[model samples]
Target: MTLLAENYENDPIDVLVGDWMSEGNMTVRAGTKISGQVDAYEPTFLEALQPALPHIAKYRIKVAVNAGAADTKKLHEAVTKMVKGQGLNLSVAWISGDEVLPQLLEAQKRGESPFENICTGESLDDWDFEPIYAQAYLGGLGIAKAFEKGADIVVCGRVSDASPVIGAAYWWHNWQRSDLDELANAFVAGHLSECSSYSAGGNYTGFKDLEPLGWENIGYPIVEISHSGEVVVTKNKGSGGQISVNTLTSQFLYEIQGPWYFNSDVTAILDNISFEHLSTDRVALRGVKGALPPPTTKVGITAKPIYQAEMHWFMTGLDIPAKARMIETQIRMLLAPHLSAFSHLSFQIIGSVPDNPTNQNAATVDFRVIAQARRAEDLAPAKFVRPCIDPIMCAYPGATPHLDLRQAFPKDIFEYYVTLMPQSDIQHRVHLSSGESIEIAPPAESKVYSKHQPTQHTTGNVVDVGSFGATVPAPLGTIVHGRSGDKGSDCNVGFWVRHQDEYAWLQNLLSTSFVQSYLLGDEYRGGRVERFEFPGLKAVHFLLKDHLDRGVSCTSSVDFLGKNCAEFLRCRVVDVPLRFLARGRI
Candidate 1:
């Protein structure tokens, strides 16, 4: 590789390959503590290496992987394994540019800007840094490290999605670290390609019903970038996604906090770029202007994190037409009075009959109430509601006792959106291999980052079993009889929950006749209480094999369960806490 004054001037690099978003990142709740370990995951080193593919031989690549673990040991192990799996005979290792840990603490020290630490407020020194798992959304500097290391492929976790593109932009354009405007343009590039398809044309308003674009094969957003910071969003040969003005318009909606947010030692003037529709799945980007970033890079940090408290209570009730009405009234009069002191309030009617597009007037509704305050103790004074269920029901004034409410009530307790931001001057290092070269081609499969696939199609069926609160749920499930019969994967199992002293009751019942049982048990029971048969209740678990998918069946891969399992922890099931129960009209 020879140095050239015009490297970025003309005949710019033909292809810049990069990967983003490793694996799991479900931030835990931040209690009184400011810096604690959270469950974070990025693609294993092997997974990251796979993306580099056979192209390792010819081109200079940057394989960026986000070490997003607060646990440095695990993070490093995964990264090391990734490279070792490639036999270390590969190319560049341009780890993620996002510097999550130390920068966060540094930001806490500076107090310049609040850190978007993924969770709540965090102080740098107090944080448990995972060198292997830590990610900083570091932008140019992070990916530039890989370029510096001579890596051709950049792999990262939780990068602003645009960090890779921006890093490449900065490198290819030869845009100096002092150039804020150019750096920002590079930032835009990364953002455009982050969601893959959104930029290439997944969920564009102009092409809502893309007739010719078969969404199943919708390719993720890819960019034909210019050294001058100009770019064209596109995808692989004959992929399903569209790349029109519509797609570009949709994917751009994220990451850009207009007047825009310029990250860490870098900033940009967002309005300078021009978007043009070239052809299907091809959108051209022009007139991207940028400037030198602010001196200090804003860092995001989270306080000591705590697991989100999840509590599920299920109580069944039946009363043809009046069930919905009675439950509403009871909650308003009984539950509401007690829970109003909290932060959020949710009420849903889950049952055979529809709720949203109310189908039959005959279906009975399942009254589900979800409420969350600051902390467990934030609503501590009101914590009395958990135990008040039986007593309150026994004293019901209704002709039918709401007391014998056969169903269970499950409420997951988690704070909605609590994150922080900080700043730092962390210099990242990218590793380039001095080993044998490997040939590779463009990213052709697993086209995930496209906006043209599916949009907010479901209105969140207000009637059936929907998420308790906070807009979307991980794997959307539906009632088998209605919407999701064969659309995805659904499995029916007798669902059961442990209440008061029902542990022995459940064990005795399970010991009878159970097949392939999976219990939602705790420390006492190895969560192996697979055999569940609640005396008066019924629970079934369903998986939308491709519930959140189009072409691929998640089960096709052994890691599929692990993929969504992470999402499950943060997700609510069938208006309950069943890890696998699903709902919807399919």
Candidate 2:
């Protein structure tokens, strides 16, 4: 909201779009709806917009957001009431038809739509948990239709994260549906802008450069897109945070699947996409090819809520491993009678006690025991907490509990199931302020593309790393910058170098086998590791399938969403060329 007001005061503003929905968020919203505690939409959206409403109305700046979450109509009504209360005449519209739980259930009853999991190919019938909610990823055309109908604000539920930008550009340019290239470019711009400050340097590995600009208020990203499909990414003038090729590259790589970026509206070919540093705080993105979208759109289905709880213990000084094992054994032995009650349980020892530590904190490591079950009572004090805590009296030397009673209580856990449904099944609709609802038709041209398409690349040939001369053992971060993010149970890590010469060495070294065996190490569980090359950006991308153990909502891993995967890989020692090392660290 602060950025919105600042951007409006500092620069020309068109549409302000915000994304507040994710797989985990959807699961949470579904639980809220089922419990009837409050409206399923994101309340923060209203809280933030309430302060900025006057500026938006005065400037006639359009607003679009997926803050509607599981309930678009309710959010639309609230926004309408807010506008009327403020005496503003701005038109508000809501897009719907993303919710498909009832429809999916009906189809499943008839043995029609199997609702097969996209990642594991398991049918919904085989899923043991009861599904409470299902939402299809709608296209941007519905939003475009709302704008064409003279809407000043649009609220959406389950539209793709990039749909708002794509819709805004489509309406601004009055482009036809056949404008694939233009739409694809807008898709890229939307992607770059979706994560707010990311494109401007929020999660960038080059933290040293952004220090002078200050991190307190990193600038929000803005894409100045032209009619020719060229995009110049920038931010509010005088805003903190640097907008450079490296920063934008980091954002580009975050949360992506592979070379072919799929959306409901169009398929963006990212293999040939390139970026150019135009000036200070400005980068131009080009060469994003376009193709017809798939006949099906991604769908997220959330099952019945589970319960989880954890207890943390500190292992200090000598015999750290022995101490951890002893405590874990004592707890397990005590809980053996009730072991079958827990659906999943784990004792994770985080960090290692170093030799001759200088401080008490450095010598201490955490041993956490996590428990998940279908019933909250299974993880209650009697069954879960007491067993772990009772062992402290007889524990190994220097064993101490973290002493947080609240951590022992059970919390709701939502499990997400990702799949795809045909676009033909969706009844996309736009509800305008004029009391008329319009139906949005799916794209006439769409191709049937397989998700397991053979790995393709635009890079001509592989480089011989031996030709780079003498090498030194150093952290990969010295010459490379990486970004990682989650998509359901899967995670992607993208690594790139600044110099063209380094691209050859990076591409040759970070192969699928190498990443799986070395970078992932014990973390590389049973799953496929797919590698992709982006020559234009001098980057290599890897997708770790089923890496997050059912993703953020249910994953017990410390890095649940796998956001730190890239940093972990970057910290690993690797053979770096002496010449590349001389070029200075990232």
Candidate 3:
């Protein structure tokens, strides 16, 4: 709200859009709805909008947000009440029909759609958990229709993360559904802007460069889209944070699956996408091609909640590995009687206690024991806590518990299932402030492209790294920067170089086999590793399928969303050309 208020006051703002839905968030919200402790919708949006209501109405600024979560109607009512209480005449509208649980269940019983998991290719019938909530990813047409109806604010549920920006641009340009090229441009802009400060340098690798400017208040992004399908991305004039090609490049690669970025309205062929440095804190996006969207859109289903609990033990100083193994053995033996109750159990030793450490903290490693079950009773303190605490008396010297009673207790965990649903099956609609409901029809033209199409590339040229002279072993981050994110159980890590000369070496050195053997290592498991290249950006991207163990909601990994995968790869020791290192490390 602070950033929004400041930006609105200083910049020529068109519409404000916020994304509050993710795969994990959908699962969490489903659990929240079932618990009835609070409304299923995100209440923070209402709280944040209360103070900004006056300014919004005064400037006649339009607002769009997916803060509606699982209950768009309830959020709409809350926002309307707030607007009326503040004596504001802002017309509010909401887009719905994203929920498809009933339809999916009915279709499955009738043998219409198998609803196979996109990542694992397993049919919904094979899923052991019972689905309680399901939502289809909707397009921007419904939001655009709401805007066309003179709505001052629009609420949405389960629309694509970039749909708000697409809708805003569509309304502003009066674009037709067939304007795939223009819509694709807007889609790219929305994707960049959807994460707000991320594109403006929030999670950038080069933080030292942004330090002098102050990170206290990193500015949010503002995207200006021209009618001719041109985009200029910039941040607020006086806000902290830098917006350069590197920052935008990092975000562009974040959370994407391959070069064919899919959406309901159109598919963005990103093989040729490139960025141009316009000036300080400004960049122009180019070469984003458009194509007909797929016949189906992604749908997320939340099934029976899994109960989980954990206890952490700290091992310090010498013989850390031996001590950890002894502790694990004891805990397992203690819990043997109740082991059958848990669906999963693991004892992971995180980090290595370095030899001859300078500080005590550096010499200590965490031994974490995590357990998950279908019932809370299976993870009760008596079953989980007693086993862990029982080993304390006879444990190795300096064996200590990182005590947290709350984390040891059982908590609800939502299991997320991702699949595709035909767009024709969706009843996309928009409810206007004037009591009129508009039904949004599916795209007139659609393509039935194979989901397993051969990997696409912008260019076929490959340079041998051995050709680069006088190679010295160094961290990849010395010459390359990267960004990573997750999509269901799959994780994507994209690495790019600052100079064109280093691009070929990066492409050749970081092959699929190299990534699986070196970077992923034990985390690779038995998943498929796929690689793609963005030649225009001088970047190489990899998608590790089933990498994040049943997605973020149920993942046992410490890096829950796989956000650290890129950084981990960047830290790996690699042979680099001395000529490139002469330019100074990133």
Candidate 4:
């Protein structure tokens, strides 16, 4: 609400939307619900909403959010009572019926299981983990229904992230389910705005360019949509931030797989998408197309605790690699007799010795020992760090550990299960404060639905090294701007140039094989990697399948979400044309 209030004061904002749910968050909420916590929803939302209630009521601004988590009805009641106490006449509505774990478990008991892992072809029962709670990804129709019934605020549980914008636009335009293109445009816009300040220079790779904008006071994005679904995205005036085609392109490619961005209501096709710069702070988005949504909705399932833990030790001075190896050998020897207690275990050496050091800490390297177990007694908090400490007295020279050693204790590791459920199984509803309710009908699957197909990437003709005239070996960042993020277990990277001439060269240079050779090499090889081009936006996008090590649940990778994947690729040395280099880069 801090940022939302800022935008509201700056512009005549009609609606405020917040997206506070993620895959991991669903697992946490499920645990809380099963544990019988009184308030299973987000606790901070009410505190944030309390200060903004007066402004919201005065301006007649509608608020929507998915902070309802596992209990939308509880959230609605709490917010309604708070509003009445403050002498505000605002109506609060909520959408529920997203929970489906009980039914799934009952079906499993009757030997009629329909749930299967989307990535792995294993049935739910075949997996070792047991689900606690499950919720299907709901659409925007319920939220729109609340708005039509004059709801001042509409809270939802596990709906799609773009549903807030989709619902608001649907109510404003009185759009039907057949309005696929308009819904697609709204879906894309909501995605652009959902992360708030991300579209306004937060987490940008080119951080140097945003320094002048007072990063401490960075503003969030506000999108203006026309009836035809065309949009102009901008930020609050007189605030700190920057908006450009490059920034918008980065947000568009975040966490997306292929060209079909699936939602409960529509599948937005990002092929040949274009963005036009209307002003320094505003850009026009167009050419977004759509198809009928898939028959199934995405669902998240949380399983029993797959508890794991780790301990870190820092080694300083020369021969860091040998020291790390010796430590690992000692720990392995100690734990060899107790192998049955652990399901998985590994030792990792992070960082490298500095060539020349100015301080002891600068030349230090870190050694980590991590273990996972199915039983809590097997990997208790006190026993987990015993192996690491047993060798400290006779360890390598200059061996030391961090002061905060509490992290060595075992912790609950929730397994995130990603699967899909038929749209007919989900029951979407709007519970109004005035004792009225609305039921949203499931969308009819199209008979001629377009199969979600990825854009065919082309490996353009390779150019001879000497043909492009004088060249200099420099980081790819010298020629392009890029961003990367995670989508389930996959990582997506999109790199774009500021000039039209650079597009052709970029397309030819960054092919699927070229990227794999530069980044992954022979490590963790063998996965479906794809490359795509957006000529209108002058960008190249890549999706690396199963790159996040099981989607951050059990990944041992340093950069789990692949947020720095593009930055890693950007630092790769490339031969750049002297003409483009002379023009200067971001």
Candidate 5:
């Protein structure tokens, strides 16, 4: 491709990741377009990938067929029989929609077309697409639009798992369109191998119960990188997942949904990467860390900008979930005596979950109810669910109403959770104008992410908040995901520090309103934080943002979901002063 990028030049890019699990939008290819958040049957090229798998020559990879369905021609004849006997170079890398849909239907029967025809969209039928698999998200803009079309190893199905090492660090080095800390150390070594079975140990909820965990052989993490974005992890041979250093420090706290999951231009500090199990599945990651935004990619962020409105109701039963939870707590006590009627009505109790012990009590319970309103008929839980099913045929005798309440489906749910904050935090444009900035080789790692300390997950940088939860105690392989499982209510628990000027004053006095108004009370007047990302500029992250308004949310997501969100945000910084719990809304 440009004669193998003018023969080698910067090296390092034999990447070949392929993760697939499909069912929907599989129309092979032709100028492909499934806009508005894309996903029209995608996955291409399997091997023969040669600027060199030419361990040297053997070529011949073609694959045809277009009009997809049936796992898009079996992920295109299993990647053309996995590039027949691997000797590939299919005229060097990228090409798949079953080998570019018979050369775009022989260039539209020889009209020598310009382009624009491929179609394939459908499957997101609003939430639960009933999908067993559906992949979309491909970022680094679809691997920089397949290396601007001269391709180089990029099969797909679901990307944005920190996109193929931020598309091999923005295509063969010299990378940097404004280095948000080297694209956040390549998006923190691709969010630790984007769910390839949680860095080789299989979604480890800290081994909640894993017995020699084979689970149909779970293995997948492999990120041997280093254009100085230094990552190591590793895996492939005899796969089955199980790398250690505490299973890669609990795979750096899976998903970590809070403190901030919003992305783009880096902030994933996941407790600053710096692992080292060296032997057993080989975990190294030697510093993926981040932070240093505000040189101006733009970030004023200190959040809480909501408008609120959320609703849901889906009931069915014979016992119809205790008569759909007494018609959802008497429709929030009959819309709380009509507060100027309908400004707010909140209630939630979606049932049938005991992890389905045959639906735990003979299966079949859908009394899902979620209501919130600043007015929308105060979130009509369907007018108190059809006058409580004729008093649920006089229920409560042995609780009846299981299903068939005249084939129920009665639906209505309006949404809103918007919270805004965009005044600036990341911005770097160097699109290469003013004559390639007089020799722009200055960024491949810019002397290893311009040193702000990235040792993978730890080598001690301390930011401790004591009584745990904001810890960075280092050496214990110091890796925490969301980078410390995204500090919402805090979790990388402690690394004892005295300065970076006490990080925004220990993050707004550990989320103030004068220290959570003595631990969440007095109409709990404080709570609102924008996504706090981290690839680890040596840690400092937080997220206990829940902006509870109207009424009730005081607490009980299992006494702190994940068995103790950093000990209830470190027992509000070691107790004493948090006496306010007279009524609720923490």
Candidate 6:
């Protein structure tokens, strides 16, 4: 809400769109409802809207959000009551019918095969878990319908992240569903804006260049979609953020699986994108192609929860590596007595001592032991805590466990299941402020799109790195910028250079083999490495297969969402051109 107000402070914002429901968050909400919570909708929407209520009417700003989560009707009622209580005449609407757990279970009972996991090709029966919540990803038609009914605020359950922008554009232009080109453009705009400050320099790999923008109050993004599908992405003037080709390009590649970005409404083919610099803090995007959407919609299901617990031990002062190994040996010996009690257990030593460390904390090593079990009682804190504490007397010198024993307590871990369901089976609707309801019919059946191939970018002329004169071993950030994110278990990192002349060298230097070499050897080299390119943007993108173990809900990786993949890659030492390093402030 504070960010929204900052956006409107300079000029009135015509529309506001927010995406509060992520894969893990949806599962969390489902657990809440399964535990018998009547109103399990997200409350953060109201928390944000309360402060914006005053300016909403004053600026005539319309708001749309996926804050409805799994309970659209309840959220609608809550927002309506809040609006009325404030004596504000705001028209509100909610899009419903994303939940489909009952429908799916019934279908299975009728002898239908279980849904297959899109990434792993595993059927529902293959999972050793039971479904607790199942919801399909809805599109923008319902939101457009609500806007047509004069809704000032639109709330939705499980809509695609980009649906709000598509809906807003549809309402403003009164576009038909067949407006593929225009819708595709709006889709790109929404994708760029969906992550808020991401499109306006937050989390950008080029933060060194954005230092002048005063990131303490980084501005959120504002996209203006023209009638012909052209988009100008910018932030409020004088706000503390940057909107540049690099910033927007970083967002453009965020979380995308391939050249094809699938939404419930359309398949946006981002193979060939063109950008025009409209002005400072603004760029125009064009040439994005679109195709018919798949006959099925993606669904996220939360399965029965498992119990997990962790114990952290610190090895201080001398011989850190040996100390860590000694502690691990003793702990494993202690746990060997009850090995069968745990379904999974791993010991990891994460921190390392620096050369001639000046402080004890710097020289200290952090060793973590994480365990998972089927039963909560099997993972009781005492089972691990007692064994861990008993080692202090005979353990390495100055060995100590974490003071906060709360980390030892077992916690429920939810599993995220991704699958597809036929769109025709869903019953979608829109509820208006005037108590009128409208049914949203499913789209005509269409063939599902086949997998997309990466765009083959021509690497202009093969430039020799030696021609750039002297070189320096520096972080990759000194010469290039990129963004990284996850789609299912895969990790994608897109790197780009600012100058066109450097593209050839960048393409040559960032091959799969080169990337694996910098990953600290084979431990990070388990997956297949695929690379793609966007010459127009001077970017090379790499996708590491199954790098996350599983998606966020179940991944044991420290960086579950893969947001750190690119940053880690950026820190890897590379032979950077002396000229580029001279220009860099890092």
* Candidate 6 residue-wise lDDT at 571: 74
lDDT tens digits by residue: candidate 4, 81-132: 8999999999899998789887667767887655766654457877788778
Question: Per model, how many backbone clashes are there?
Answer: 123, 0, 0, 0, 73, 0
Per-residue CA lDDT of candidate 3, range 545-579, in tens?
87888998888889888899888888888889999
Position 15, candidate 1: lDDT: 41
Off by over 4 Å in 6: 2-9, 107-114, 445-447, 452-472, 516-520, 523-525
What candidate 2 gets wrong by more than 4 Å, as runs, is 6-9, 456-460
lDDT of 1 at 198: 59
lDDT of each: 0.40, 0.88, 0.88, 0.80, 0.37, 0.81
User: Candidate 4: what lDDT?
Assistant: 0.80
Model 3's alpha-carbon lDDT is: 0.88
**lDDT per residue, candidate 6, 1-586, as tens digits?**
6456545766657888999888767877887778865677889889999988888877778889999887888898999999999999899999988999998888767857578776666788787788989989998888988988899999998999999999999889998878888888898899999997898888887776677778887878889988777889888767787888888888988877767777777778776885778988889996698788788888888887888788888887778778878988898888776679888888888767888899888888778888877788887756766776678889998878898988688888778877888888898889888889899887774556764346333234556768777888888876788788876677788888888767777987776677776642544755666677777788888777677766787666678888988887877777887777676543
**Candidate 5 local Cα displacement, residue 30, angstroms:** 21
Give the root-mean-square deviation of each candidate in angstroms: 19.2, 1.6, 1.5, 2.3, 23.0, 2.5
Candidate 5, 143-172: lDDT as tens digits: 444444444333443333465566666565
Ranking by TM-score: 3, 2, 4, 6, 1, 5
Cα deviation at 279, candidate 3, in Å, is 1.3
Worst 10 residues of 3 by lDDT: 452-461
lDDT of 2 by residue, 418-452 (tens): 98888888999999999999998888989987776
Model 5 TM-score is 0.26
1-586, model 1: which lDDT tens digit per residue?
Answer: 1111123233234444344332223222212112344334443435534554444433433344443433323454455566567565444443433445555445556775443322222333343432222344445455664565566545544455556666666666666666655566667766677654655555443333555677676665556666655667676655576776545644554323233345554555444445776775567765556544443333323322212112222323334346445545654565545565555555544445433434333433334444444445533323434433433454323323234422223222211222334232444444334532222111121112121112221222223233323232222222111111111122112212223222222233233112213221120121111122212222122222222211112122222223223223222232332423322221
